[model samples]
Target: MRAADIDKLVSVGRPTIAPDGAFAVFAASRPDLTANRAVGQLWRVDLPDGTPRRLTRGVSDTAPRLAPDGAAVAFLRADAKGKAQVFVVAAGGGEPVQATDARAGVGSFAWSPDGARLAYTARTPEQGRYGTVEGLEPIAEAPRRITGIRWHANGLGYLADRPAHVFLIDVPSVDAEPFYEPAPAVRPEGEDAPKKQLVAAEAVQLTSGAGSYGGVAFTADGSEILAAVDEIETDRRDLSSRVVALSADGGTEREVLARTALLSVDEIVVASDGTVALQASGVGEGRVDFIAPAVGLYLLEADGPRLLTDPDVLDLGEVGSHITAVGDDFLVQSRSRGTVSLVRVSRDGATASVFDGDVEVAGHAAAGERIVVAYATPDSFGELALVDRGALTDFGAPLRAQGLVLPGEREITGRDGYPIHGWVAVPAGEGPFPVILQIHGGPYASYGIHLFDETQVLVDAGYAVVYCNPRGSAGYGRAHGRSIRQAMGTVDFHDVIDFLEGVVAGDERLDGARVGVMGGSYGGYLTAWTIAHDHRFAGAIVERGFLDPVSFQGTSDIGSFFGDEYVGVDPVQMAAQSPMAVVDRVRTPTLVLHSELDYRCPLEQATRYYAALKRQGTEAEMLVFPGEDHELTRAGQPRHRVQRFDAVLQWWARHLPVTG
Candidate 1:
């Protein structure tokens, strides 16, 4: 099997099971290399039969949720412009109704338990000054004339004066009388007729202060609501969240729960017994736990908060393991050996795997006793499978291998004696093929054993693709993951080069002399630094990366705070770690990619890098996306996303031509 062929077998997304447990909804996109630009769409899987059907026809429809009565499914639908709006469609599949009309966009939403009202958070335009404030006073002068609207920073958009507020929409009654009656009068062309005013829907503001609500959930009795807040303080980024009970009529609010430090509540599910089950994470070690009765799963209700299951529950051996809740149960995906399993925790503290095999389950959903799992094997892209309590056999038949061959995977030792795991996809029917070294972003994030589209594309185009998780990558212990701080271009780059050499040594099909490198964000920073420090790479692509830490610290939205964790000391360490400080050594053909609205890294990062390369007489080009932000890869402009992929392919083909 070739890596490109594996695209047909692997699927990645979280599915939502209906309240009745009769059906499940999920998002899937073709992973074919030739169809690399295909957008994701919502698909429905019927229980018992396990037959999957496509529901909405669009570029990408995500975050599917079944209504309380199971009459409709509400999801976020993105159009060609990449603007996502709240849409609802019949549970049985029919015309979709557009619910939101905001220009900024709608992300996470919730349908009230009563089904009469819908509460959602809307993104609004923001305008603010861009500079540092040393003391209590504003250091930069406020813009005299604001030419462009800033959205909510934090990788979303520029910040606006108005914050995202929760808006309540009353479901239009099927037989209620019209709210407005028009005046019946025809006047002459130049004469003005009597004006009639229409009744405007009133929007009730939930939380007032400066913070923005991240997620919302309705109580089982439909009397109160819960939300996560990320507040903006004077000096630091404080994320103090609480689960408050608000009057159904939108009047007063009483705090039922509160936390001191940073907390992320991913999902909340109310059990049949009125007990609230939530998946939450606190500051410090970032351990995910199931919070209930203010205690862990195994402990008695009277016994304070206990750790039901620690990090060792998944038995990932050396690789790290994390669990994500899917309805009543949780789905655990292991990154070490790459296997996914359905685990159920009983009130008695017993844990069992419902279904386990060689296939790596990417996502799962549960509805009472029925469960739906999405999985992909080494030879397959992705396929949907079903499981039930009493069933002894897996519901779906084994899917045929998609004819894609995956490359061999291996672990190499880095300069620090740490195990650096990587995968190498060799071209089919090839000898001495050009190579591409791909690095993942989120210096903290790791590339899992799951299937990827770009890897397949490079292999199909007759190039050996090598992707690795170097030092500072997750799945390792906290100390290993935090070692890259203040050493950006130093240790991290050395580990990547070590992994690349190890891959080429084992695979004779790879051409070491004709290799290229590319990455985004942190990965982009490394790509820029690699070419700047060494001329080994024939070509390079840097996407939405930080060129100069000093300038990035001032321009980025979280500039002040991110410096402490990423660069340690302060802006001084930032300048020393920045690739721009030594750009005169770059000699490779480089392509700089960035988005205009990117507040995470800012467009200036790309501009400075491109300018530096040109001044040094190096082959460099810049591609700026018009209305895109930091999420250009997963949630970028649709047309430009396709263009970006095409540009990468063309650039690689031009620099390193494929040989027979």
Candidate 2:
């Protein structure tokens, strides 16, 4: 498959099955190149029989929550003004009506236990005109002051003075109507028509003050809302969060649980008996790098927050791990060694793997033993699958019909005796095909088991694709990852190069001399490192890479934590880990791609390395994508993604051309 084919795949996520299990709804997204947009909408599939259907539409609509009564579904969507507001519609279908008029837009939300209210979090407006003038006239060129460690974020730039606070919106009763005359677009079901607009429910601001709060959930009686609190402080280099319960009516609050400087709390779910289930990180410490802090599952009871699962035996699975319907048990989407699986862990710390193999489960909805999930594998895009009593049923028949070519995977021994997992895709009718070693971003994140579009495109262009999880990658215990802490270029570089050496030695079909390397973000940093220390690669592509940890610590949006987690703010260690420090040693022809608005890595990180390579007289070129950030390759415009890949193919063809 080619990069342009990414628009054709229907991506599924946020699957929710009703309490009674009559039907299920999930958010599905599709890219439209002709329209220059990607739209997300909800789809309802009849349970057991499984007939998929769409429910709402817009630039993007996600986060499907089934109300307690199962009579309606509340979701977050952008209104006509392009602001996210609460909206609801009958599960059967009809025009959806806006519920909240939150001007600043909602970040996330949850349905109360009784479903009569929606608890949400939205950013409050900046203190009026910098506390002086009334509007834009006062702040156009006004000096913006900063006193917080988290001054900037990746997608959102400066934090300003605004804070995101918990909000409550009441749901109207079944018998209600708008108090005004309707517009001409309204469909008059005459007295027979179901209710169009429920009596307008007032939006109420709950918790307010210094901290920015989110991850909203409900107490058992539905009289209070619980949230994860990020209390704003002078120095927040130490990441942490506390759980707090706020009065549903918006007046009172009580601190429920507080963690230490090492751990952070997320995804807090409360049980019927007031038992709290939360996923936390930093249970086991002593590492300096960001990848070693393992997330452990915990349960909160009368005593306090108690660790429920051991990180040594089982790491809290993927980012979607949550408290399960069975109060005592919760489903952990975990990554082990290299593969992702679903494991069920109880409050007492007993853990059991429900399913483990060559599959990546994104999200799951459970009703006793009937657990259905949104998952994918090597060849399939995102699809719905059911795991009933340990037997698997694949609902991705249509995706299989699309004929996506999947690569074969294998495990290799690193030069240091660690197991490195990798995948290879060879072109049809190939003999000694030119090879390209692909690296994934997030030196801390691992590659998925599914068919990645970029790798597939390279394979289709008559190149052998070999990609793997080097040291410092996730899913392989904390020790293996933290191994590259003060030693980034030394250990991780040798791991990939040595793994490539194994691949070329084992496969006679690969042309060892004509090989290229490419990656973005952390992947990009490794590419820069590979070219610096190794001369075997003929070409290299580095996109938004970290050149020097010292510079990164000062410029990056996440700069505050890099000093503590990456290199400890030492100058000698920073220079040792920098690719630019040894730029003159690079002999391979390289291509650099970067996004203009990427605050996470920052644009200067790219320009500095590009200038150094050119100054050294190495054959190099740089391409910049305007109006895009670090996620350019993943979530940027469909056309832009295709264009970026096309450029890479062209550059590789010129540098590592096929020769008999």
Candidate 3:
């Protein structure tokens, strides 16, 4: 498959299974090439056989959560401007009803235990947040004031003055009989979305506080709502979260428990027996990388909160919200090494892997005696399947015929005898094919389990793809992951080279002389570091990556704290770790790609690296994408994502051609 062919793949998330295991629902997203946009919609899958069907085709309908009784499903649909609002529809089939209409729209929601209400989050609309034209248009056109230290985020851009608060939406107990099931929500030619008559929903402001809140849930008896609320009167970026309980009637507000700065509740949910379940974590003394915070299941009862599961491989997957409670034991999603496992955690602190596979699970929902999950293997983007007992069913059948290149696993030891995990994929009949070492973005993220789009595209281009979880990468344990702090390029770089050299030497199908290294974010950091430190790479590609930690402290969002924690508190120490510090030694041909709108790395990082390379007479090319963010690959414009991969393919084909 080619890079553009990535559009053909569909990914599923936010899964929900029916009570009786008859059917399941999930949100499926795919690139709409005709519309030049990525669209999401609700989809249903019949259990046992895993027959899939699409439902509710809104512009961006996502986060499908089924009601407790399985009578209805509620989801959030984004408008043309991408402001989200809640919507609900009957499980049987009917016109989806708009359920909530807050001024700032809705964030995330939880269904009340009795199904009488939904406790959701909504931002209080402020003057500057919206305008007559549309969301933040007036502010973007004329902006002079800069009050907040952290102003812009990558995907969301400028932060609104309003803070998000908890809100409650009444779930109608009656069923809706629509006069007509309308066609898919579509925008007319040269216009916004087609006008529609939607049902008005009653909403009430649940928590009026100056703090940000998320990971909400409703109690079993429907008396209170639980959420991770940070009411600290400080910068929203630095606030530590705590679980808070708010009355369903929006009357009482109480902190459920208090945690030290060392640890806090990442997610909170109430089981059927009124026991509170949460994933408590403390990555370090104070680390900012929330992607793979060292976490374990914790339960709160009359005695107070304590760890229910050991913090070994209990690092929760990316989805922090969906903490499924199956009876007293909670079905937890944990990642060990590079593999994501659906683990069942008991109150007695015992944990067992529900399913065994060399694959990653995106989400799982329990129904009757069965479990439905959205999983992705090394060759499939996503598959919705009925995991009967502990076996994977026919979810990958539809996508399997599309021809995917699956990788084989390999392991290598890094410093201190740390075993670094990696995967290698080679095309058919490979004779020392050109290699592209794929480095995942998050220094804490893994790349081996998922059907990595870039790996597939590169392998199809006749290049052997190599990816690994270096020292800094997660899925191992706490000590191993935190080992990257203050030692960014040194330790992780050794792990990368060790794995690459071992893998290349062991296999005759890998061309070590014609190998290229490419990565983004932290991976990008390592790629640039590798090029400067070692001169063997044929080419390098670094996107939305760090180059200098000195100026990055002032320019980038979360820069000050991140540099302080990750690199060092001193300016000289921070600069010593950046790739710009050793730019004078870089001889490898490098491609520096950064997004103009990427506030995370900031475009100046690209400018610094590119200018240094050019001044030093190094072969380098720079590409800056307009209106894109640090998430230029996965969440950026579909066309741009394709173009970015095309650039990599062309660069590799020119520099390290696979000769016939």
Candidate 4:
């Protein structure tokens, strides 16, 4: 597909089903090239063999949740000029009435058991700060007291000053206008004609003081709320989190439900029997645990946390995986072998696969025996599918008919006879095509069996793409993920090389001599390291690479412990593991791409690598994207994403032309 097809790309978000399993509501979004942003709306479909219909017409609406009684659906809606606010509409369809007027807007919300109230999270900016006062410009605001490690985030800057807190607001009537504002009292000329005073309902702040609280949900009885709390400490440099049960009445006391040493409490769900299920991962307090710990599903039992899934085998939180309590068991998204499928985990830890196939289930929602999933296969980007009687009924078709190409799977023996799995996608042609060795970031994230725009674009431009999940990637169990720990450029590097060589050698349609290597983030780091050590590629592109571990420990959002945890504290060893230390060895023409506002592997990484390469007389260039963070290639502005794709094709054309 061409880069401009980005505007036509469609994706589905997390879905919610009605209590009676009659219908489901989900948000689907597509890029708006005219506005240079994504626009989303909510859609609903009846159970079993029904067609989907648009429910809400907001510019950007997401996080749809059906009320307890199934009479209404509540979601977060944001206009073009305003922050997201809570809006509720009828389940059938109608106008959505705004239920919140939070100054900073809502982050997430959950419906109470009674369906009369909604518990949500919103940042409480300090007075006289963040435009809390009228006519106050950001330049004139008071200086921030920098004391916390999480003072600034990538997309949302300066987070420590305004911690997100839980709030409770009642849903407004269907016909109510200006729901958050009180109507002015009117009277006749004399003393008292007929007085009418309609006071606005105020949302009650549940939790207070420091720390950011979210992922909120109400207990079965609606008497209490469970939320994951991240107390950003000034002394410690970790994201260790805890779960607490707060009284729904805005009580000051919070009962600590669960806490771990190094694991982050990613998601929390309360069962009907008062049991709380948690999704957590980590081995110890050390930073190495953050490198590749499996996300496990656990039950916060009275005795202790009981792990339902094996930590080494099953990752419940991979690739947008989610958990939904069903009966006494939980239906969780489990990732393995580059595919995410639904797995049923019982209370006693007995596991059974609900839906296992050659597809990646991004997210799913279940009600009773009904399950709906937003999934992707090799030929389609994403589509909403319903699971019934062990069969999947897809609801939609792919956007483009011609440009999509299915990847051919390949396996090769690596170091010590270990198997490395990979895939190759080639354009429709007779002659051998120039190859692009594409590497996925996360070092811990796998290249799933899905239609990736990056690979498709390269194939459409007359270049074959080779991508693999080598060592240090997820979906292959914990050992494979942590194989490259403290030894970043060793086994993982060889595995990638082995996969590329094996694929090209076996395929007659691939031109190994005209190869161009490119990757982002950790992939960028490996790309830089590969070109520096082995000059086989004609050109290389490193985007948002972690080149220097020394400065990364100070500048990146997760840098405080990431570099030290991955490479170790030893100065000499860190230098040896860093790509910047061996940058002078690179002889390939390189193109460095980075985001100006990226907090993860900040812009300095690209700049340092490019400057060092230029100083050594190696051909190199750098491109920086403004107003975007590390997620530029995935979720950046629409125009910028197209521009990036254009730049990549141009780079390959100049260095490793398909015709040449």
Number of the top candidate by lDDT?
A: 4
176-271: candidate 2 lDDT, tens digit per residue: 454554445556666554434433877788877868898888888888888988754575555666788899875488988765534577688776
Write one digit per residue (lDDT tens) for candidate 4, span 457-508. 8988999999999899988888888888889999988998999998899989
Candidate 4 Cα errors over 4 Å, as ranges: 177-200, 258-262, 283-288, 389-398
The worst-scoring run of ten residues by lDDT in candidate 1 lies at 287-296
Worst 10 residues of 3 by lDDT: 231-240
Q: How far off is residue 146 in model 3, in Å? A: 5.8
In candidate 2 the C-alpha lDDT for residue 60 amounts to 80
Kindly report which residue pairs in candidate 3 clash with one another: none
- After superposition on all C-alphas, the RMSD of every candidate to the true structure, in Å, is 7.2, 4.7, 4.7, 3.1
lDDT of 1: 0.65
TM-score of 1: 0.78
lDDT of 4 at 64: 92
Candidate order, TM-score descending: 4, 2, 3, 1
Alpha-carbon runs more than 4 Å astray in model 2: 127-141, 172-199, 283-289, 389-403
Worst 10 residues of 2 by lDDT: 389-398
Return model 2's CA RMSD, one decimal. 4.7
CA lDDT, every prediction?
0.65, 0.76, 0.76, 0.83
Better of 3 and 4 by TM-score: 4
TM-score of 4: 0.95
Better of 2 and 4 by TM-score: 4
What digit string (tens of lDDT, one per residue) describes model 3 on residues 1-660? 777776667787858888777788888887765666788778876767655676786877888988888889999987545678888888866668777766667888988877778888887755554653466575375554655556555665555455678888778533654434457766678866544544446677777655677878887788888888754333434434577788887548887776454456667878778888877776444434443465777787766767777666577745433467887788888887677778888889888788648767878888545877777776667767666543233444544566777788899776568787889999989487988887876777767577777888887889998889887777788677778788788888888888898898889998888888999988888888889899888889988887788888778876746766678877677767889888899999999999998888999999889999999899999988888988788778888888888888888888888782
